[model samples]
Target: MHRLQPLANGLRTDHPVPGIPFVDDSHIPIDDPAAIEAVICREGGASMGRWERMNEAQGAWLAYTADPLRPELAWAVRHHPEHGRTVLLLLTKDAPLWHSSWRGPKLLFRQGGYWWDGTTWYRPDQAWDATCKHFSLRPVPDATTITAADILDENARTDGGRLLDVYRFDPEAKPPDSWNEHLAMWASQRAADARPLSQCVVRLSAPELPADQLIGVPKMPNIGDIVAPTLRTYIARIQRELPAGDG
Candidate 1:
């Protein structure tokens, strides 16, 4: 039997239904009779069912990655009052093309919110918007290769060269306590350079595969299935640091 874990911060009510162990404000509550019945009538089950179905559809893709790029996914997990969890899923047409044959697809996911109540996710209205602003994405011209250095170089050559900034990806792992420090450094440098940290534009290092030769359209996985373990880990870490309550 699965055990329902306690929420670190008192953000969610701890209510458990068999099969679905982690029930809290992060999910649409099942206790409301009207909402429950509505869900059942329309979708046959509640949020868990919906999650499962979504997971199945998303999991079919050959390459799928998810991050809190969109407000919906973040809102789902953060349970922010003003802003909903927004998520973005990227599905690759084929294996990521890397400049170095030794380098493979390296996907990284990050979670963010305005307030961390030591356990649960929270955000003031202003804070929520500010956070959302940082999580925006922009399109770039399709190319065969892209690197942080290349972006900086492009900006240097452009008319708005002064507006450019340099961003670097950390390859080494660090302790949890150092995360904020690293982020602060990165943010400070970017700010000093006057560039907004935005979505990464991926470039292919090889020719595109013909559509006829490709398999089914790649799909992205739902947040629940793709990062449930990470979510649970975050929940546990918050519980350890904050007051005990259902999250």
Candidate 2:
């Protein structure tokens, strides 16, 4: 139906669904209730629903528009009260986009906020007037609709497992004792391989002497004479070894 689905169980279809002009000014209804129902039925029997959260005084409106940049793309919308201004939600109605191959009727809670009007593609304003005009709209019903803030909070709560999968975190890892410890552990896991202080050790080896020659021990250099003595000793050792080979 070009008309909206009856409001039931927290969802009301968008009425006077936005229609887009095609090849010869003939428009295709963008939010066809039957097509929406077919999609819902195909995808595990989910509902394409809207829930009103604010009255007309709060300046929220649920809208729909075909994307100008990608004609195949369509959007469901809800205006939100942010601070003293208004914001728009490119809504997904009943399920997240990820659920139905990124085509579910997910409602816009607070994330996935992209602004649009039928004529223009992407915008960032609350822009109720511009949007309504662009889509040939009337006053949408006064009811609670989904907002970006609601979805954002839901995403934060529900995305923990998905994030863990993205970074390949060990699911069985124990909770860190403190926040600092947690940070340190995370850094250690991600940083490059380094030979640790505990693994480093110094080894000393004596110079090999021929069995026939008497071993002449050189005096150790004091800290003050370390550089000079070290150079002298190296030179003397090389000279001595050369002469012995000549013999």
The residue-by-residue lDDT of candidate 2 on 58-113, one tens digit each, is 44333333323322233343333331111111213312221221121212211112
How well is each residue in 22-130 modelled by candidate 1, as lDDT tens digits? 1112233322323322332214432311121122222211111111122111111211122111111111111121111101111211111112221222221122236
TM-score of each prediction: 0.16, 0.17
Overall lDDT per candidate, in order of appearance: 0.21, 0.23
For candidate 1, report its TM-score. Answer: 0.16
- Where is model 2 poorest over a 10-residue stretch in terms of lDDT? 1-10
lDDT of 1 at 234: 39
Q: How high is the lDDT of residue 21 in model 2?
A: 9
Residue 183 CA error for candidate 2 (Å)? Answer: 21
Q: Could you tell me the lDDT of residue 64 within candidate 1?
A: 14
